[model samples]
Target: MAISLGLFSSLLSPRETSTLTFTKPSPSSSALRMVRTVTSSTVSHSGPSKIRGIMKPRKVSPEMAALVGAHEISRTQVLKLIWAYIKDNNLQDPEDKRTINCDEKLKKVFQGKDRVGMLEVARLISPHFLKSES
Candidate 1:
């Protein structure tokens, strides 16, 4: 069966309708029925939960700090912030979005390359992520 992501997403929202029912083992036993209602207010508002070995913060290299500023950031957050910076500066090629043009600041992170392909970005940024300290 084919699943439509849009349909699935709509159905999974906390506001979506759903019901749960359970019968007591013994009516005279005074067993109580427990029910938890689903609603936006009942859902967790916290940010992403920690994954044991993932999302660890790494020291930012001096070169990269010049662009995104000096701070400890997770690899995922670093990539996201870099992409935001690139978009804010309109550094992506107009004709080919996959090609990122390096500005003066970005040139430092990209190791002075005038332009780099989207696939090469991760490899270029890898060195900037320092090994996590125990």
Candidate 2:
């Protein structure tokens, strides 16, 4: 039987090389023998990645920004910040973990609702993300 593995580490800046080993099991014992080694590097991107779609940061409304502390943020990031706030303040209901109890800060963002389901959070924040012409 043969086992194939594809990195070795002699780190150099952003580039690294690792020994790619190909092994065959020895008949006499349970251990395998390394037959070959080849070094490879991690690919470096030519430029910074583009953030698009829901991940693209956009201007938010005053109420939204107050809670998130950022004038511009992606939908993904907004959700993360909101959840972090919830956890930090222990906003989730004891009876139901999926439900969030609204404090004054959350109330502004959640349209003055006292309670919000986890699924409702994503939809609720949609209006807060202002449309950008670009």
Candidate 3:
């Protein structure tokens, strides 16, 4: 004899197989829950409630000072200033616009490199800056 399975079968007997039911979470509820969790985690991990000290400007080296003409500046500003100088002096290579032909001042910054790519300009100029350690 064959037995037919029905939805009510499980509810009728203790030995009956259990059926799983899943309900999707509402979008708004899910979003609110996520926001709450993230906010709590951020609050817990946040080190200080308020900033403790004023930011001090980084010191500039003599070589970098001559290049940047400033006592202290951000790395980004230094790059922009160097590019401005290069443009003003017409240091870009005439043959290939992508190449930079260093002048006397730029040569010092570039470690005597006669030619460099535009991409390398930032890296070469960084050495001229005086870091606290060196």
Candidate 4:
């Protein structure tokens, strides 16, 4: 099952020897389709689209700005600052840690609700963040 092209090895350079090791490609339909898909995706794609979401900074309400200490900030940062504020002020209900006792500062941001559930923070804060039309 072997054919000898006698001493042809002596004729090839190191580079040509490596190149000769691989069989010539005759890609099947699926292989070609995969190559096409990969090639299409590797092409460049860039724009402002990458920066248009909750991660993007947006203007905040006056109450929110005062609490977050910034006129404009991202939703993620706002959440972090709000949680920090709650922790610093010891605002969590002792009996049920899931409940938040809104202080005067938090009351303004939370629509004057004296009590807010932990999970409801995000929903209540949604109104404080102005609609961003990006």
Candidate 5:
């Protein structure tokens, strides 16, 4: 009879190595038992899964200079910066919170529109970003 065993370790250096031995049961022994062991030198560190999407930074246009300036930035970061600007400037409509009143700089980004809705802000901001050539 033959038994197969598998082992895995994530440590760079282990001061002591633990050995595992498997023994065959005697004919007289009727009860069945199993033992499993895991040895490690350090605790593993794992964080949350990363967001999935194209995370490359895109070029910012002149209209978006007030928010992200001319430097390249990710779409998610651009949205966050825009929202921060809106909140800081108190541009969101009081009656219709979904609507945002455009300031001078935002007016250019919004295509001269005096006001725009939250859902449509991304669409308006899209044109201001271009794929940066490597």
Candidate 6:
């Protein structure tokens, strides 16, 4: 009988595996690179920051008046009440979770926005609040 050495030799060979290697950069160089990256990012973001619109309460129109009633409240509150009404009446879209199916009242508040995401609720509703008397 011939002894088989193939299996033994295979076991002796190193198994194939993947490895990730990272080289440590000098402390000063690493710090400089980090500073440069941060500076560039900030500069890029600065333009959008200037374009931001002021968050002032806008005058409530007749349509908005009916939805929120005759009262002054923060835009956040208006959105909360609107969501509450939607929940109570089951106006949420069945097919898409993010879409809101507006009833008559919500349709007015949403300004004909047939489908709205949860995130845009606050932004879209902000225009409905009564602007402060100045």
TM-score of each: 0.59, 0.69, 0.53, 0.63, 0.58, 0.50
Error (Å) of candidate 3 at residue 101 is 0.8
lDDT of 6 by residue, 1-134 (tens): 12222333333324322222334456666632211111121223334443223433345767776777745545555666787888889887888778888777777777787778877787877666555676
* Greater-lDDT candidate between 2 and 5: 2
lDDT of each: 0.75, 0.85, 0.65, 0.77, 0.74, 0.60
Prediction 5 TM-score vs. true: 0.58
- Give the range where candidate 1 is weakest over 10 consecutive residues by summed lDDT: 1-10
Top candidate when judged by TM-score against the true structure: 2
Q: Residue 86 of candidate 5: its Cα lDDT?
A: 92
lDDT of 2 by residue, 50-89 (tens): 9889999999999999999999999999999999999999
Question: What TM value does model 6 have?
Answer: 0.50
For candidate 6, the C-alpha RMSD (Å) to the true structure equals: 18.4
> What is the per-residue lDDT of model 4 for residues 1-134, given as tens digits with 9 covering 90 to 100?
22223244455543333112223345543322111111122334465456767888888999999999998999999999999999999999999999999999999999999999999999988888887685
* lDDT (Cα, tens digit) per residue for candidate 5, span 11-123: 33464333344557779986544444545546554876664444657778866866666477778888888998899999999999999999987888889999999999889
* Quality of model 1 by C-alpha lDDT: 0.75
Clashing pairs in model 3, backbone N/Cα/C closer than 3 A: none
C-alpha RMSD by candidate, in order: 13.0, 6.2, 14.5, 13.0, 9.4, 18.4
- For candidate 1, write residues 1-134 as lDDT tens digits: 22222333346665554444444546566764644444343565579776543377778888877777766777787788889998999999999999999988888888899999999988999888777667
Candidate 2 lDDT at 72 equals 94
Better candidate by TM-score, 5 or 6 = 5
